[model samples]
Target: MRIFPARLPDCLILQPQRYQDNRGFFQETFRAADYAKAGISEPLVQDNWSRSVKGVLRGMHFQRLAPQGKMVSVLRGEIYDVAVDIRPGSASFGQWQGLVLSEHNGHQLWLPPGFAHGFLVLSDVADVIYKTSAYYQADDEGSFCCFSAALNIDWPVTDVIRSAKDAGAPDFSTVFP
Candidate 1:
């Protein structure tokens, strides 16, 4: 696996080496030692999966009490994945990075505990799976509006379909202050 540091140094884009044959392709998504060597020291405790249609947007969400470090990848189709630096005191606070993730590329994004994560579907349908360092805590979760003016993320699609929770999420300023 090759781990590349993202624009926010703590975030990582992990690419697994694939071996292909006439039958199919094989790749190792996670190996404890390999991940530890790449500086991803957290032990993943939960796995979550979601499917969305084109124009669907989810997140810009994170937990404050049990912050989760997540390793996210696309299982089918494609998406524009985003991670925003929200850690207080970090030099890049309020900044974000976006990447194209698709089944064909087999790339994964490792978002450490201090960032908010989200994605927008770019295909007819997309399936996303993620491994999280922490368990889900409903009372601990929080979200900033995906299209908050303060963050001003340049999401690929304009006509987004969002859940009631996400649509009514607080803005970045409200989240931080």
Candidate 2:
């Protein structure tokens, strides 16, 4: 596997080496020692999967009490994935990065704790799977409007579908749906 440093120095974009024959291909998505060598020390403890259709957007979310370090990749279809550095005292605070992750690309993104994670489905349907360093705590989760001007993300699509909670968030409720 090869790891590429992203615009946000703390984040990483990984390309897993694939070996192929006539039948199919094989790749190792995670290897602890390799990651540890790359400066990722968190031990992943949970895995989550989400499937969404095109035009669906989910999150700009993070957990205040238990911020998670996540390794995200797509299992099927495609998506525009984003990670925003929200750590108040960090050099990259308020900065964001976006990447196109598709099954064909076979790439993965790593966002350490203190970053808000979000994605927009770009295929008919997309299956996103991620491993996190910390367990989820619903009561500790915090979210910002995906289209908040404070962040002003250049999402590829305009007509999007959002969950009520996201749509009702401070800046999104009255504007930019």
| Clash count of each predicted structure | 0, 0
Query: How does each model score on TM-score?
Result: 0.97, 0.94
The lDDT leader among the candidates is 1
lDDT of 2 by residue, 1-177 (tens): 788999986899988888889998888877888888888899999999999999999997888878999999998999999999887688888788999998989999999999989999999999999999999999998888888887789999979999998787665323212
After superposing candidate 1, which stretches have Cα over 4 Å from the reference?
none
Q: lDDT for model 1, please.
A: 0.93
**Model 1 C-alpha lDDT per residue in residues 59-87, reported as the tens digit of each score:** 98999988999999998999999999988
Looking at model 2, the pairs that clash are none
RMSD of each: 1.0, 3.0
Q: Which candidate is the best by TM-score?
A: 1
- Cα displacement (Å) at residue 163, model 2: 0.8
Instruction: Enumerate residue pairs that collide in model 1.
Output: none
Instruction: Supply the TM-score for candidate 2.
Output: 0.94
